[model samples]
Target chain A: MLLTDLVQELGLTPLTPQLPLDEAAGIERAYVSDLLSDVMGNAPGDGVLITVQVHANVVAVASLAAQKAIIFAMNRRPDENTCLKAAEEGIHLFSSSLPAFEIAGMLYRNGVRSLKE
Target chain B: MQLSTIISALGARVFVNHNSDTCEIDHIFAGDRMSDLLGAVSEQMLIVTHLSNQGMIRLIELMDASAICLLNGTPPCPELQEAAENAGTPLIVSPFGMYESCGIIYSLFKEDTSSL
Candidate 1:
């Protein structure tokens, strides 16, 4: 799904609105994990990450994992500095009230798949 | 999902059984970070992680997780194994990577759910 569509469908609040949604790549795969090491080692490139980790290291890990966007579950939001870092790293940031499992299930039902697929 | 069934599916080796082969695993929480696992802990949850340290055993014991499967065939140290054995927490080592292990288990979950 397109980034804009994902934002609309999931009712996600954009944390990095300055990043143009239209210019961003589409998301066909997603990995749900709060572990930065697991994400760095297993997450697919150019995919979306659904996690509850809102620290600055998340931005670094997302960038290293080549994730196009990250959805912070459970309505968790990082400080503005972290958001700025994400924006600087060219990674889109979104927030959702739903937990990571529910967000992943919704994405899976919408045809998004894990990295192994 | 029985712990033994997951062990067979992942081609995993059991280092500490704790007589938990028959334990029912109702959830799978895959992560390397203990803090993340801490929040999702349950008595029937199987933790899939790459961390093979004493802290993992402590987390398993503290959270009362059913079992913990270490991916990439990483074996726990003797101290860690002793800790798990002492705590009666099942420790499994899987030959598969984190992604493949989670995928296989997730497929099993899907099949089990669909059958019902």
Candidate 2:
């Protein structure tokens, strides 16, 4: 499914339009993480981000590493500065109320692939 | 659905990226151990953990994840916030335990129907 469609279907919030839902290409799977070190050491650039750390640094880190979108779990809202940073970076920020696993489960049901064996 | 709904649904607390409540998400992942996450490879994934440290920011940058979720209602450490701001990656906090949070997210978002 398209990113926009998925967003609407799942009832999520976007911090910015940087991640164009229409531009769905190369995004073959989903990866979730909370540790920055782990992400840097292992994660690929072809997936999305579902986390709860609300800060501008997350934006910079995600952008630098090249992530599709950043999804906030547990309804973690971002501050003004983080929003501005996300806007500047053009990074897509998404929020969900379904905790972390629930959100992941939903995406998996929606046909989103995973890296876990 | 608006990103705000997702946040509300997941019961996550937004420390930053409030304006990003309109952003869209496709998938998610959960883990606190940096080594476990780093060892795996995937696309368009979000991370869930309880460890709030600046180093986590660097790891997020390296993986290029969609976002990071601090589990167990733990707030982001000062250094983590700084790194998040600089990195421009959205961060969130969840009150639910890691296991429960993952279950909720998976049931609501996971695509594996047969498994369910």
Q: Compared with the true structure, what per-residue lDDT tens digits does model 2 show for residues A7-105? A: 887798876755566775544455566656555544457567777667557877777667767778777878878877877776678888755566666
Go through the candidates in order and give each one's C-alpha lDDT: 0.81, 0.65
TM-score of chain B of each: 0.91, 0.77
Q: Identify the runs in model 1 with alpha carbons over 4 angstroms from their true place.
A: A1-13, A28-44, A97-117, B96-100, B114-116
lDDT of 2 by residue, B2-78 (tens): 34555776789887683456555555656565665675425545667766765587776676555677766778887
State each candidate's clash count: 0, 119
Location of the lowest summed lDDT over 10 successive residues in candidate 2 chain A: A35-44
Best-fitting candidate, scored by lDDT: 1
**lDDT for each residue of candidate 1 in B1-116, tens digit (9 for 90 to 100):** 78888889888989999876678888777665567778878878888877777778688667777788887787889887887887788899988765456667766677678421
Candidate 1 backbone collisions, by pair: none
TM-score of chain B of 1: 0.91
lDDT of 1: 0.81
